[model samples]
Target: MERDPPLVLDIDGTLTRPEGWGIDPRLFDPLLEWEAPVVIATGKAFPYPVALCHFAGIPELVVAENGGAVYTGDDVFFTADRDAAEAVAREYEAAGYSLGWGPEDTVNRWRETEIAVQHDQPVEPLREIADGYGLEVVDTGYAYHVKDPAPNKGDGVRTIAEHTNLDLEEAVAVGDSENDVSTFEVVGRSFAVGNADDAARGAADEVLEDVHADATLGVIERVRSA
Candidate 1:
């Protein structure tokens, strides 16, 4: 039985359904009440799910923008690898791919590859670049994202652990998409919930068949079992 700290979980498709449907409050309740910290590592913009965390009473670190943006309740840590995101975004745009909401520096995205392009970008061209990078490109049917090198979930997990003063070997992360693979590989324990993609489920130590499962509840059971 290993006793380790719990750190973060992906929100869309991992915890609740991507659209915020069929979520069991019990699933989130434990995470909110847990002695260990449980954060949300998602591809959503800073505010959308950040607001969800607020409503759920979650105070753990938030790894958003696929890792480009890391938020702790009191502070937000933007990525340091500005060059990669900007370069990536630039390459995609030059290929005639339009982007979604971000690229604040516009150059940061072309330089560091820190942002996910879905809100304002089309899916086809985004998929083309995702393939070009040898990175994982994910389409939640709502958004298209680029998380090949930097500013990914795994990177976000590391940043979160550092911010919380938690040990990497003490944390657990679970996700359900290809974008989650990087973050999934960085944690001590990784699990794929029932609703996850095959790549994600294969990446985890456990594969759950409980679609519509509660991420917090699945984790609570793991706590007891572990």
Candidate 2:
């Protein structure tokens, strides 16, 4: 029998239901029993995806902080310029805008390579400031991430693929936002969930009718039956 292709998934809006912030319970068993490696790629911090993989009983393959960090189970490495990201964050703060979280903000407490600002904050200004510092701002729908321009989900997935000895051209990826576009570009086939933003939909090879985790499950089913 032919082996299944490696799968790369986005966590937040792709794995979670539209009404909730957590992963849909429906995804647990399928992911846990998947024959091929599953990589969780997200704009979320490093620890979040790592923890999710740990509890899900999946390998700790991750592309976190929008590709600023990559964990290949045996080793972990960072690509984005943390110092540049921090400088942008500091400047953003000085411009009289709140980072959108409190002093004890858990949103960015563990973030190493990028800064995540709440969505409600003005994004244009953040983008301008990031550009001045030779950085970029990506809106993930949930938040605006200020980080290095070079490191993106594509780079992260490539790193994961390389370490796992998987063929990048045969991998499949699924996601629902702009941050996922990079991954879409790198994978052999990519799916954008029904609720995906325009950029993701445009980048993906196919746009699914189902939304969120349902779409992800559908993709898995499609791949399995192929």
Candidate 3:
């Protein structure tokens, strides 16, 4: 049998159920049984994807913090400076926003290379402040990430492909938000779920009718059949 192409996937809106934070139970077996590498690429903090990989019984290949961090099982790579992101967050806080998750925010506690501000917070102010520090603000739909402009999800995908000795031209990516646009651009084939934002739909090679984890499963089946 031919080997399946490597896959890069986003977490929240792409793999998890739309109604809640839980990972759709259907994804576990497919991930474990997948023939090629499965890379979890998300704007989430580093530890979150790492832990997910552990429990899912998959290899620990991850692109977390919106490409700010990459883990290839043996080594970890950081693309940006966390202090700069922290500075941006501090300035946003001084401007009278509460980081949107409250005083003891766990959302960004384990984050290493960037700060994730809650989506409910005003984005313009965060963007304005990030400009002064040479950082960029990206809305992942789940949150606004303040971080370095140099690295993105595409860069992380390239790094993973190189480390795994896989061909970029054969990789497949699936996602549902703006943060996913970079990965869509870098991979050979990309799918945007039905709930995907405009940016992701524009960047993807194909837009699926299914939403969330269901769409992801559909993509897997399509690839497997091909």
Candidate 4:
């Protein structure tokens, strides 16, 4: 059998149901114990995914802040234009939407490349504002991220693949949201969890019937068997 490719997983809707860090410890135990190159790709900022990796015993690199930062061990590399992101955040704040920049609650505050805000607020206006700054507003099912359009989960996966000496053709990506669509485009194979949004399902190569972690577990088994 061919060697299993690197597996890239989105944290929010793919690892667990969409909520704030609502993952069950047991859900990822098997993945953590597996001897393979695994990465946590999330729209969340640094230290959040970093902290999760530590807690989950996942020792590989992390793609955080919606592909703005790639965390490899103790070092982190940025991939977005920070000044543009800052301007976008300021624009939101000036428009009466709180920036959500607190260190404790605002994971985006810790990010270097992207600004994440509560998606519950008005989005099209924010998108218009972000577009003015040559940025795109991505709704990651958990938050609205103002970022450079080019850097996404796909770019993050490419970074991890290069860093780990793996080919992009030898990778599988699993996700369940609109932001994950970029990831679906970059990998050789993409699996959309049953709970995935329409855009995500449309972008994926295969759509699994199970939802959330269940779908992720099934993908893992498929990869192992392949």
Candidate rank order under TM-score:
3, 2, 4, 1
Candidate 1 ranges with C-alpha deviation above 4 Å: 1-4, 17-23, 80-122, 128-137, 140-142
Model 4: weakest 10-residue lDDT segment is: 17-26
Candidate 2 clashes between residue pairs 3 or more apart in a chain or in different chains:
none
| Candidate 1 local lDDT, 1-226, one digit each (tens) | 5554776677677666534564555666666666677778877766655777788887747877778778766687777444444566678889877675544633123323345566456666665665665555566434666555545778877877777766777777777777778877887888887777778878888887665445546566766425
- Per residue, candidate 4 scores C-alpha lDDT tens digits across 1-226 of 5666678888887888434357845556777755667778888877778888788877858988778888766567788767897887788778887755454655655677877778667888789999999999888777888889887777877877776765677678999889888888887899998988899999999999988887888888878734
**Residue-wise lDDT of candidate 3 within 1-226, one digit each (tens)?**
6779989999999999867467998999988998888999999999999999999999999999999999987789999879988998888888888688877788899998999998888999899999999988988888999989888998998898878865778889999998899998888999999999999999999999999999999999889724
Give candidate 4's whole-model lDDT.
0.79
lDDT of each: 0.66, 0.90, 0.90, 0.79
| Pairwise lDDT winner, candidates 1 and 3 | 3
Better of 1 and 4 by TM-score: 4
TM-score of every prediction relative to native: 0.71, 0.96, 0.96, 0.88
lDDT per residue for candidate 2 within 134-189, as digits (tens), equals: 88889898999998888999999999888887688888999999999999999899
Model 1, C-alpha of 212: deviation from truth (Å): 3.5
Worst 10 residues of 1 by lDDT: 105-114
Ten contiguous residues with the weakest lDDT in model 3: 16-25
Query: Candidates 2 and 3: which is better by TM-score?
Result: 3
